[model samples]
Target: MGSAVSLRRFPSPEERPAALRVCRLPGVYAPQADTRLLVAQVRHEALWPGVRSLDLCTGTGIVAVAAALRGARATAVDVSRAAVAASRLNALLHGCRIRVLRGDLDGPVGRERFDLVTVNPPYVPSQDARAPSRGARRSWDAGRDGRLLLDRICVRAPGLLTPSGVLLLVQSSLSGVAATLDALGRGGLRTRVVERRTEPFGPVMSARAEWFAALGLIAPGAWTEELVVIRACRS
Candidate 1:
């Protein structure tokens, strides 16, 4: 609600006074640091009427609901059926009208463009190489080097935007921040980091810390991870 946001430091999620209604599926993704940080950034935007916002990887529809709360028409997409159900329920509970769809990233919004697209896809370095087809791993498992879905999103998501539309994507710095910027930039969008934040390694990251450490992705004793929100816009 001010002027422009700062980029040279870790961005904190703007604290809200009242908690909103949220539901979660067991073993499914629940909103965490990345979620809160992304939500905070979305709130700072001037979401005027008719600004359509799409939330990709909307585990519980929290980000979409936040956009709707800020007066933007919102849509949420996810591949997990449980996630889709959870998102719909949360939207209803929050009194926000949201179209929740159950399908892979680009399928639900085929040929439909939005003014703003929000993404919080899996970026954690995981063990699985093949794409996760089900279970909780679907939310976190990315192929080695951790750019599996990130690459796909960077390539496909931009095409799903209206002219002058914006893409707000959140991922751990470990997934190659520069690569993301380059991918989007090469794809013809002006990109920049709008927000950043750090949190101690969550359980998933902690478990794989040793693997990544061996590969020199993380320090031997590193216990925290940095997250960045990249804002890409088409003019």
Candidate 2:
């Protein structure tokens, strides 16, 4: 896993493979740039067989499955029932022994500690002040500031990790990367943005670019957004 190889980036129709390995069900947030970035970082981690890995807001469980395939004991949690079901199906399809649970973030896995944790939760800032607890909106419609779930993860994940454990969280820079670093830093974790990738706006983000710009979330005509993967290791 030295000198990480960027996994297949899907930008153009011709660039993506005709047959996909990921089993994406409808309403389940499909793997995009953030997912690929996190997966790439996951591959580079010093993982061992039987090491415990947890995926928060696991979605299709691709990240958790990748950890299991790498010989770690992986567990994934999601708030959406469809996401949990899709995760289970995809894990089975990929022949990975991943435990898929339906719950919000780490709620279902009370007091469970892990060697590594991966988070790609809902981080998009939406007009709605209150984020939806159910339906497809829960996949990305975070609160006005977009740290609805990110804040919780920063507060809880540090305590959920083993002494030598590390957490890998991926979210858009618009959601406030500096805020994330500060929150995790307060938790006594050694944190830093391990990876940064600039990607063109997706449909959801593109639609909100104007709104974000109007609110000064971005510069006018800033059609692109940067995604970052933060690596926070326990001190």
Candidate 3:
């Protein structure tokens, strides 16, 4: 597999590939650095024509579509209606047969096993104890310390994978990479940091900088954060 690609910035419109372009309505999360970063790692996986793949928290369904294009039988799940619509729309636009479902994480898939599972779930720390149930903020806001979805995934992902399955997950450093490693380790999966990229604070992170520092989530006066893609496998 290729080494982790360092993230820089979102590509300009003209630079984006025509095949992967998507239509996003307001309240739906647009594909960003995290999405592209995850997609890059997805390309590195050994996906055969009929491999079963699942993408949780699929916003625009870009990751699922990518897997489908590679000939994997891909399924995507999301809780938000808008996100579900956007995911289905993108799948149709790409002419990929993706089973897009409207439900939270693995709940929608139920007892199904997959060879590969990918997720870019909400990981941003929010003062609110629970992520917003309704709004665009639902795409990125996790409860205090930002582990709400991350923690659940670490616990649940192992069960969702087949015996030899692999999982690719992306999240920010502010969300506690070590905690994730430990959780997945306890879950019996061998894990590694496959990719790491430092990105400047975006609007949300910028606005929460002071609060983050106060809560000791970030160093005082720090404005940059690292995003990491973690690969876990059940051998």
lDDT of 1 by residue, 25-67 (tens): 6646768889888888888776798699999999888889889
For each candidate, C-alpha RMSD in Å?
7.3, 6.3, 6.3
Candidate achieving higher lDDT, 1 or 3: 3
Q: Tens digits of per-residue lDDT for model 3 on 1-235?
A: 2223222233432355443667676677778878888988888899899999999999888889889989999999999887788778777877889998999889988999999999999999999998898988899999998999999999999999999999999999999999999999999999999999899999999999999999887899999999999999977
lDDT of each: 0.84, 0.86, 0.88
Model 2 lDDT, residue 78, Cα? 89
> RMSD of candidate 3 to the true fold?
6.3
Each prediction's total of clashing residue pairs, residues at least 3 apart in sequence or on different chains, is 1, 0, 0
Mark the 10 consecutive residues where model 3 has the least summed lDDT: 1-10
Give me the displacement of residue 145 in model 3, in angstroms. Answer: 0.6
Stretches of candidate 2 off by over 4 Å are: 1-20
* Minimal lDDT window, size 10, model 2: 4-13
> What value of lDDT does candidate 2 attain over all alpha carbons?
0.86
Name model 3 segments beyond 4 Å from true.
1-19
Ranking by lDDT: 3, 2, 1
